[model samples]
Target: MTPFMFVTDLDHTLVGDDAALTQLNQILTQHRHEYGTKIVYATGRSPVLYKELQIEKNLIAPDALVVSVGTEIYLDGKNTADSSWAEILSTGWHREQVLSITEQFSELELQPDSEQRPFKVSFFLKQEVAASVIPQIELMLEKYKLNVKLIYSSGVDLDIVPRSSDKGQAMQFLRQKWKFAAERTVVCGDSGNDIALFAVGNERGIIVGNARQELLEWHNQYPANHRYLAQNFCAGGILEGLKYFGFIK
Candidate 1:
């Protein structure tokens, strides 16, 4: 377990619609200034979105970003992704599968060329085999022994990676680059994709009230492990989390 580095999700875990910092917000700067504690937001947003947020002051210019769902990595406002990641996603056993899955479940039409799209093509999975993806997506992958990473985002969006792309991996990179101990890292969010990160960083994840029931029911990693917020929403949840951890006075 890490000493204590409070991190959170952006959309609903940290900031609310009123654009106010919930409990999480109040303590971020306070902890940094008063206690020398740091806070971070790990999101699916990309560099472009980060720039937009900086302009609006929605984000305090992240210390680092785990953005673009792992396709790209940026540090100090510069691209620092490992070369191998991009290279692998470009070619893999799952490329065709992901292409087919996207066609059926995703909004974008499945194309052989994912380069033209907003997200980079990490790999293609053969999604055409209809072995009841709903009941046993993981089992199917295991049966075939796929060599890829599967992640879900804020929405029902599924991401395919070459078994190496994940927020945990992204954080591990940032941890080394920044000289911060991985054990000291904590993450907060409200999505399934966030689950992997939580597992790796165990007891360090702060699940919001809006989290799915499966997570809510099973997450006993930390008692009150999840802070129930009165707001039941983003900003409110952030506020709740910050205060729950006593980040704010």
Candidate 2:
């Protein structure tokens, strides 16, 4: 049997229900032990916050971590950074300049220092104001000739990352590095940012039933038979999707 890659978002998508997550963890652990399945956790959290979640939720550590909205990748453990991925994000990324421009916008409330990374800048802007402020920020960044990508998720959280860096691109990098078949890669998410996860490659997708409006809208726009919209929520939803995709019975 060929091993497959399971990449999932942390918050809301995989951590909402303790019992469901525990069951999913057991299944994943067993799968890894029996078949060498590769697991990855992707999220917008910084390493510090990711660790906190691991402890608080008792999540099994993944083989790789795509954190800071895909601005950083960690392998072996949370402490070991993927230097190559870092190098990729370094090009055309001007964190300070991005900060300087965003700071001028009072509507954008800067997140804590820990949330800000070398290749990603994070903020909290209300949904109502995001429509206007996001474009304004984009225009300002364009005027400065900065190449960056803005990701807004869960309605309020906004992230600015290098144009070449995102959840999908990070997944692509991992797939290429690991030599995993694109069709065998499974991704799960429940928010706007997760849209990129579905867009990147031929990876099968599991969008939880409780997905946010942004994600649902995107799914409706680009319907794909490869992507499964699970009726269950969070980890349970993931289980439903895995079975639907024939990864499990």
Candidate 3:
């Protein structure tokens, strides 16, 4: 039997709430052994931080990790670089230059250094500030010919990553590498950053109830037959999606 692929975001989707995390852990652990499902985490977190969260929350590690917003990939317990992605992202990436450009915008506060990666830069911005600054930042990126994409989520978090690296692209890469059928893959996420993961057509998607408004709007604008909007939040939502897709009974 072909193994089903379950790719999910960590924060605000799978392991966000303690109660939800526990439920999700139980369900996944049980189904994983019974159904021969493969799990992957497509997250904006770096590998180091991902591990920290796992330890702190006592969460199960995924079979693979798509970290740093898809700029990095790790299998099992080993860290490995996706060189093809790296080469594609290298064209116009100058982290220091991107930082210097954004530093002029006082409204955009730098995120912790740990959040910074070779192919991604992160910042925090208030809703009002984001409204005004994001356009300007886009213009600056265009002017400088930087091949980066900016993703804003939860009204505060702003991530600038390589144009080719995102949760969706990373998930697709792993899915193909593992030989999982498109119809057998399910992705769950709850924020704007997760939009890309859902946007990957042909795969099933779950948008948890607590998802950001931006993501909901995006989903509404382009509804897919395979997408499920769950009434439950986080892991509960994931379970709902799994059942909706007939991955579980």
Candidate 4:
């Protein structure tokens, strides 16, 4: 039998209303125990924040965590760094340089230090300024020859990480480590940050109903049968995706 793997983003995609969360937890728990399906949480949150979310939102702990927008990986309740990922990020990345450059833009505000990670820097850009300022920011990165990638999501949140680090790359790393076939993997997400996950076309992708317009647009750009757009929001939508992909009956 093919080993199955389920990966989901935590924020608005998986964490929903109390009823939805309860149903989601129940479904996930059943799937794990009955089929041994592996579950992973892919998020921008650090392990610390993730644990807090687990408690505050009553989320189920997963088999593994791809945290800080895929720069770090933790397995079986033990926080472990992906050394290869770290090595790739170590060169050409200067957090202070990125921060100093971004600070020049009056429209950008540095996110709290708690959100910062060794290979990632986060900032908030007002919706109105995002359009005009992002290009300039990218140009600055280019000018500095920084080996960083910029991710803008929900029209306000911005993240900069090593060029090689992303949700999709992290998923790929874990999939290889776990030896799960691409055909048996399912990834669910709802924003721009998740585009990389969907871009891993060999694996299934689910964009829930409440997905941002940017995500919908991105999905439409490259229509594929492997990617499904769910009609339900949050956990309901994830369950719908699982059913659509025949992962669950």
Q: Which candidate's TM-score is highest?
A: 2
TM-scores for the candidates: 0.66, 0.98, 0.92, 0.94
Model 3 per-residue lDDT tens digits across residues 32-52: 787778889888788789989
- The candidates, ranked best first by TM-score, are 2, 4, 3, 1
Candidate 2, pairs of clashing residues: none
On lDDT, the candidate that comes out on top is 2
| Shift in Å, residue 24, candidate 2 | 1.0
Q: Tens digit of lDDT per residue, candidate 2, span 1-249?
A: 558899999999999988999999999999988998899999989998998999999989799999999999998685867999999988888888998999899999989999988888999999999998999999999999898989999989999999999999999999999888988999999999999999987799999988999999999999999999999999999999999998877
Q: What C-alpha lDDT do the candidate models reach, one value each?
A: 0.54, 0.92, 0.85, 0.87
Question: Per-residue alpha-carbon lDDT of model 1 for 1-249, expressed as tens digits?
Answer: 122455566665555455555334454655666655555556655556656765665566555566656555555455565454456444444655544444454333332442222333322234353234433555545566666665644334556655766666666565655565654556677766666556664434556767765455456544444343234566666556545554443
Write the candidate numbers in order of decreasing lDDT.
2, 4, 3, 1
Report model 1's TM-score to 2 decimal places. 0.66
* Regions of candidate 1 where Cα sits further than 4 Å from its true position: 1-4, 22-26, 33-36, 53-57, 79-131, 134-146, 153-155, 176-183, 217-232, 246-248
Model 1, total clashes: 21
RMSD of 3: 1.9
Model 4 lDDT tens row, 1-249: 334899999998998756877987887788888878899999988778998999999777788888989888878877677677678668777888998898888888888888888888898988888888999999999999998889999888899998988999989988988888888999999999999998965899889999999999999988998899999998889989988888887
